[model samples]
Target: MAALADAEHRLGRGLPDDLRQLLLECDGIIGHTAVDTVWSVEQIVAQNLLFRTDSSFAQLYMSFDALLFFGDNGGGDQFAFVQTPQRPDIFVWEHETDSRRWVAGDLRDYLGRSLAEGGDAWYQ
Candidate 1:
């Protein structure tokens, strides 16, 4: 939990409380029958940083400064938050189309829907 806080502090902002609690419970989740995994705090920071600097992504989307990536769908698609308000909503970034779509209104909803659907693939 301290590690998560440290990562958030380094990023200069806090994660949504639901996400913080989720991370505290488990560093990340491995899909029941899928290869996808939500990233740990460290992994999230690293992945966000990597994407933030990618030249191609920058050319297309300006910047990832307002986003915080949390997971990936094993096939290259990413799950993230838009970083607004008290509870950040979930969005999925499709690798093939280079587009993003809202998945859930909040972390709890995302988890429930993702689990109910069996895995992250349902969103794809």
Candidate 2:
């Protein structure tokens, strides 16, 4: 709870309720081949900050100010929550094409799909 609160403080916004509950229960979720399907509270804060402020990213891709990144596919693509409109839906930020698209309905749905048989590229 302290970590979550700290994360929220650092990010300047509250995370989704479902995500907060999950993080409180466990530091993070690990999936196939030991990948961090859902990142820990610390990583969540770090990664989001990096994406949002990295100078190179600013030139390479669209502004990340509207997204709250939380996980990665072990490939380069990442998962995030839409912060612009503050929805429960999760979206994938494909690094290659700079495309952002809906993937799961919420954190629960994201876990089911990402941890299933298809390995890390489940969203693909």
Candidate 3:
């Protein structure tokens, strides 16, 4: 749990006001979405988000890819993740104080960034 907290702290420092606002507005986002279930309020913290781990989104995109983080080094951190089709591998890009909220983007961003280095894919 300490590790999770530390990771979240690290990520928060890098997040931006926009993300914070987004979080506050939408209660955080997910990389891969699956299911019609509502998440517990406790599960939607600014740092952590809970979404379906394995779903159809993975199958629509090419095999798992990588991701890039756009969070800050300060107190506005965020995260991103790209999962493989077979879903064996996961590429993560994150910045936050709660490791639980380490994933903050969608599959498109994750896959695009995962192929690049340090958020370079965003340029593509």
lDDT winner among the candidates? 2
What is the per-residue lDDT of model 2 for residues 17-94, given as tens digits with 9 covering 90 to 100? 999999989998989988889999999999998888889989999999899988898888999999899999999999
- Candidate 3 to truth, TM: 0.22
Q: Which candidate number would show the highest TM-score if scored against the true structure?
A: 2
What is candidate 2's CA lDDT for residue 19? 91
The superposed Cα distance between candidate 1 and the true structure at residue 6, in angstroms, equals 1.8
Clashes of 1: 0
lDDT of 3 by residue, 1-124 (tens): 3433443464333233333334445532332222111121233222232122335534443222233232222222333332222222223322222232232254344444533345422321
Model 2 TM-score on a 0 to 1 scale: 0.97
Ten residues in a row with the worst lDDT in model 2?
A: 115-124
Q: Model 1, 41: alpha-carbon shift in Å?
A: 1.2
- Candidate 1 lDDT tens digits, 38-106: 778898878887887888878877467777889877888888888754446898888777787898888
**How accurate locally is residue 92 in candidate 1, as Cα lDDT from 0 to 100?**
89
Candidate RMSDs in Å, in order, are 2.1, 0.8, 14.3
Q: What is the lDDT for 26 in model 2?
A: 92
Query: Would you list the clashing residue pairs of candidate 2?
Result: none
Q: Candidates ranked by TM-score, best first?
A: 2, 1, 3
